[model samples]
Target: MKIRQKSREFIWGIYDFADTIFSMNVVSLYFPLLIVSDLGGKDIYVGLANSISQLLIVLTAPIFGIFSDRTGKRMPLFIISASLCAIGTLAIGFSAELGAILPVVIAFIFANYFYQLSLTFYNSLLPRVGPESRWGKISGLGTALGYVGSIVGMILVMPFNTGKIFGLNTFIPAGGRIATFTPTAILFAIFALPTLIYYLRDERRSKYPVDTVNRHPFKKIWETFSDTRRYPGIRRFIVSRFFFEEGVETAIVFMGVFAEKVMGMPDSAKIVFFVIATTAAVFGSIIWGKITDWLGPHQSLMLVLYGWIIGLIVLAIFPYRWLFYPIGCWIGIMLGGVWTTSRPYLLKIAPAENVGRYFGLYSLSGKAAAITGPLIWGTIILIFSGWNLFAAYRIAVATLAILIAIGTIILMPNKTLFEKHPIV
Candidate 1:
């Protein structure tokens, strides 16, 4: 039993490793560059693509959550959404090859929507992976492995762009930015197979069973929205998450573009920078996971938020080429810490029976923030386009810093709110 459970935990974590490959390579790094630099599009196209996909996720996430809760199943949905996400990602590569910006954007939007949608089901699987006491460590392990995936994904995909693996010339034809998409889609599908197979075979039901006969997903969404008042800190936490996630999501979408445009880093240098940053994130996720266990997720999350506020401000004002490495490392650490703490934090505060619904709200909060955050970033960039381009990008970073600061303030009072919940 112990070995089986441990295997289950590891397999669950592999999915994190799998999905993040798509996120790091496609969403965060290559796709934006493909849009703006290679295809002659603007920042707004990238932002709009992200926002549109997020809007679709936000509209449907709650309903998806309610369905998961009612049916007491997550794996089938996870597999279906994840498979579609891979297909969509492959379509992106094909569309880009056609040399049409609109097709690339359309494919990206399709890929991103399913990618985000899959996370709604994926996140709710946390409780099934381990006992509640181990949730923090387990979540951390998954996040750490995810950063590792980012590192590996970057290295694996680099050959496509550079035509060389580890500084050696290779026969693999360098297709530049366009070559990145197909392999990324392939990796996403390959790595995801383990978890999909594991869950399909296990066929276990959730501890919290719901009335399948009296299903009312839409009404349940409303009821869950209203029922948050009963959970004490959840409403406040979600609200706070909305504000901070806006900053985080915007950064993730624009960071690659910012590195290229503002810092004038070449693609190879940018890859090195991200690897260093992602390494820091790997360590940070592991350390912060322990901290979440020791300090409790709420307190730990506050510390992570404080780190974001400070880091974003420094990142905005000081855009020196020399400082970019250290600052990138800092942001990467906070990025790992944020997700590491937030997942268990939600699990800690909410009742076990409604985990799916609340995590849906969690996804909803983040996706809603995602919907506006990129648009806000694009608007800021557009508004200041007439000015120095570098200055405009810096100003956009400063705006995100302010948003993180506001989220910190709102989250501060939640130390007391947790006291009202019995789980705490």
Candidate 2:
């Protein structure tokens, strides 16, 4: 039993580790390039897809969360959603080969919707992984492993990025871009498998029991949604997180496009930049994991927010390929710190039995802001047509920096949130 429990914790890291494989390689790195360059599409398509996906997640995640809470089970939804995400990703590669944008868009919608749903279920599992005191370390371990996965995923897909298959003698002329999705899907499935299999059979007794009175899942979800005022600290934190996350998600979702249009960077260089950033993220996750436990989640979040503000400002000023090496590292560190700190903080203040619902709302806040960031970035690009491309990216990033600054102010006076969990 002890060994099995330890294995489950390790598998938790595997779950996170798999998520970034698709996130970095497919979504952040290749998809934007495919849209703009290969399919001759606009940034607005990317933005639309991103916004629509978030809208789907925002509407559906809480329903799923309420279901998990009502049923006292998480594995069923995890398995189904994750498997579909992999299949959807694989379909993307095939869609690219067919030279059809509609199929690719549909596949992206399928993959991203399930991808967001997967996180809600995965995060709800965090509270179940161990004691409350170890939440930071556990979340950090998973995030660190996630960055490591990002590095490995990027390396595996590098050949595809360059249009070269290592084993094949011939290159597929633009094949690398489309071929990337297949291998990424495979890698995601391989890492994600252990968790799915383990949880499928190994049901430990539930620490959070189902409520007897709440018979309808939708009713429970509605009540939870309406009762936000009861948790003022969480409400404030969610609002603040919404702002900063807008900055982070915008930067990440469009970094490839920015690199391509602004820096005139080749596909290979873009992959290298992601590798550098993800490597920095690994260290950031480890360092901040400790800080999360020591200084608490709120303080750790503040530190990362400061990093975002400074990093965005510097990148806006420079916006050069050569400079991205250092600038990417700064952004990576903050990226790691954000996920590492936020989850433990949410866990600290949430009602234990309602963990899934709260995380659903947590996902909602981020997704709600997520809808705006891509739209904002894509719209800014449209608004600045024929102007200096780099300047457009800079202005967009500057906008993000201002949002993060406001978020920093909102997050000030953390006394209320911290009072519940002093050490976090």
Best by TM-score: 1
Candidate 1 lDDT, tens digit per residue, 1-424?
Answer: 4998888888988988989899999999999999999998889989999999999998899998888887788778889899999999999889988999999989998989988988888888888788988998889999998899989999999999989876778889998989998899899899989988887666573355553535577888888889899987889899999999999999998999999998998888888999999999999999999988888888888889889888889988898889999999998999999999999999998888788989999999999999999999999989898878988999999999988888888888778744432232
**TM-scores of the candidates in the order shown:** 0.96, 0.93
Clashing residue pairs found in predicted model 1: none
The numbered model that scores best in lDDT is 1
How far out, in Å, is residue 279 in model 2? 0.5
What lDDT does model 1 reach? 0.89
Q: Give lDDT: candidate 2, residue 153.
A: 90
lDDT measured at residue 301 in model 2 versus the true structure, 0 to 100:
85
TM-score of 2: 0.93
Off by over 4 Å in 1: 204-208, 211-215, 417-424
Residue 239 miss distance in model 1 (angstroms): 0.8
* lDDT accuracy of residue 305 in candidate 1: 86
